[model samples]
Target: MQWRNSSRNYGLTSILLHWGVALTVVGLFALGLWMRGLNYYSQWYRTAPDIHKSVGLILLAVMVLRLVWRWLSPPPAALPTHTPLVRLASTAGHLTLYAGLFVVMLSGYLISTADGRPISVFGWFEVPALVTGIPRQEDLAGDVHFYAAWALVILAALHALAAFKHHFIDRDDTLRRMFGRAKY
Candidate 1:
């Protein structure tokens, strides 16, 4: 089904950004878990952490662009007959995801900066340090980053499950609106 806002379902740009961010977030999560499992002195562990930081900064930049795109092009219309509770839940869930993601990225950057490490953006560019001192800030930022990461995982899982429910049980076009209709 064509989405309500525009003549087409999700525009090509929207679909690309959505899938790109999804893949990046999932990869980051797995990398994070792997890095956490390694010993601090392990060279492999060091590499993973640096890669994670670099990829995360890239994700942050993409997310900013995604936000701008979203503002310029709102999501496809929701079901016309959603109950008030469902509407509230949807709004809360989306807001939580956006806020949590922003915080997670910011905390990661702060953590790296606090540790006196320059954040490399996808190995192409470096983000300048925000602060030079405060080791304790790094510890606190680490805690915040982990907490936000867990929250993001939970939120993303729920969002995906909800999409599946709409597609399979509700037999709605909600998922297809984002993914587009099958070519065949």
Candidate 2:
């Protein structure tokens, strides 16, 4: 597959970033949910958080790359079959997805460092705290991260449903566009 996008379809880089970010975000969410349920005696209570912080940092890196890629190579145009409203909504949705990803990661970082601890990424290196010494800052970050994450969940679901709608209901190549199978 081509590495760069064309007017007709998204290139491989976009597709990989799209699906890769999707998986990592979902996995991180699942891990966060599971860690919350752990009892004090559970080994994972300690280990899980370390893993979460490490992977979340890696995900932040990937998200940065994805954003840079998107800026350098915007995706192909929205499906020509879409109406004016659909086009506008599509643009908004895309922007929200990108912004949400950034906010979620940033908030996660804040929550991790709220207690004045450096984030150790798999012990290879440490990410210095973004914020420190603010009273109850972690608590505020926790709340923001929670709500923003839920919002991202809703938006991502809607995005997926719309893709399925176009593919199954509207009989279009919306999903395939990212795979570079769309005809010119």
Candidate 3:
């Protein structure tokens, strides 16, 4: 299928970044759920919490890169005769997902920093604190982060269902275009 945004199908860089972010997001979701089941005070939970923090920071970094890539590359064209309402909904949903991702990551960082913990990026290095030491603020940030994560999960499920609809029911090129393939 002809790309909607650019003339060519997505380049190698775009495809790689798309799939990489997808995998990371799925992994993060699993990790988040697992951490919720653990006792925060236990040693097992200690490492898991740190892993969560580190991976989250990494996701934040990657997301920033992804945004830049999206801006520069754009996405494939929408299906022909797509209604204005459908187009608007598509734009709104994508914007919400990106915004939610940023807010969730930022809240996590703020919560950890306020708790007097250094944010580590994948165990490689530490991120400087966005803000330090305020118990009330930390508590508030933690609450926002937790709820935002759940919102993301719900948004993702809807996004996936939409993609499936396009791929299966509509028998369209929406999914394939992103994967660098032309519609059959």
Candidate 4:
């Protein structure tokens, strides 16, 4: 497949980034939820958070790259079968998804770095905490991270449902395009 987006199809890079970010978000959310139940004696109690933070930092890098890639190679236009409302909703949904991802990531960063410690990403490098010292920063950022994660998951589910509707009910290529298939 092509490596850059075209007017009618998503290229390999876009598809890879889309799935990578989506899967990582869901995985990190699940890990975060599971980590909350661990007690002080649990073997994974400390390990899990370290893993979560590491993966989160990597995700942040990928997100930044994805944004740059998107700017360099914009996505294809909405399918012709999409109505005006559908097109608008599609745009809004995409924007909201991007915003929500960043919010969740940023809050996660704040929660991790509130103690003025750097986050180590899989032992590769450390991201030093550049912002700290606000009272109750950790607690507030934890709440934001928790709520934003849930909101992002719910919106993602809706996104999947919309793609299903376009594929199964509407019989359109909306879903296929992300796989680098195009109706055009």
Q: For every model shown, what is its TM-score relative to the native structure?
A: 0.88, 0.94, 0.87, 0.97
The count of residue-pair clashes in candidate 1 stands at 0
Q: What's model 3's lDDT at 69? A: 78
Once fitted onto the true fold, the runs of candidate 2 whose alpha carbons sit more than 4 angstroms away are none
Q: Mark the 10 consecutive residues where model 4 has the least summed lDDT.
A: 175-184
Task: State how far residue 7 of model 1 sits from its true place (Å).
Answer: 6.2
Best to worst by TM-score, what's the order?
Answer: 4, 2, 1, 3
> Any residue pairs clashing in model 1, and if so which?
none
**Winner by TM-score:** 4
RMSD value for candidate 3:
2.9
**By summed lDDT, which 10 consecutive residues of candidate 2 come out lowest?**
175-184
Off by over 4 Å in 3: 1-5, 39-43, 133-135
Model 4 backbone overlap count: 0
Q: What is candidate 4's TM-score against the reference?
A: 0.97
Model 3: per-residue lDDT, tens digit, 54-81?
8888888889888887888776666674
Candidate 4 segments whose C-alpha is farther than 4 A from its true place: none
lDDT per residue for candidate 4 within 1-184, as digits (tens), equals 9999999889999999999998999999999999999999999998999999999888988999999999999998888779999999989998999999999999999998999999988788899998898899999999999999999999999999999999999998889999998765
Compose the digit string of candidate 1's lDDT tens values, residues 8-97: 367767888888888889899988988888987888777898899988888888999988888887776666655688679888998998
- For model 4, the local distance difference test gives 0.93
TM-score pick, better of 2 and 3: 2
Backbone clashes under 3 angstroms, per model:
0, 0, 4, 0
Q: By lDDT, who's the top model here? A: 4
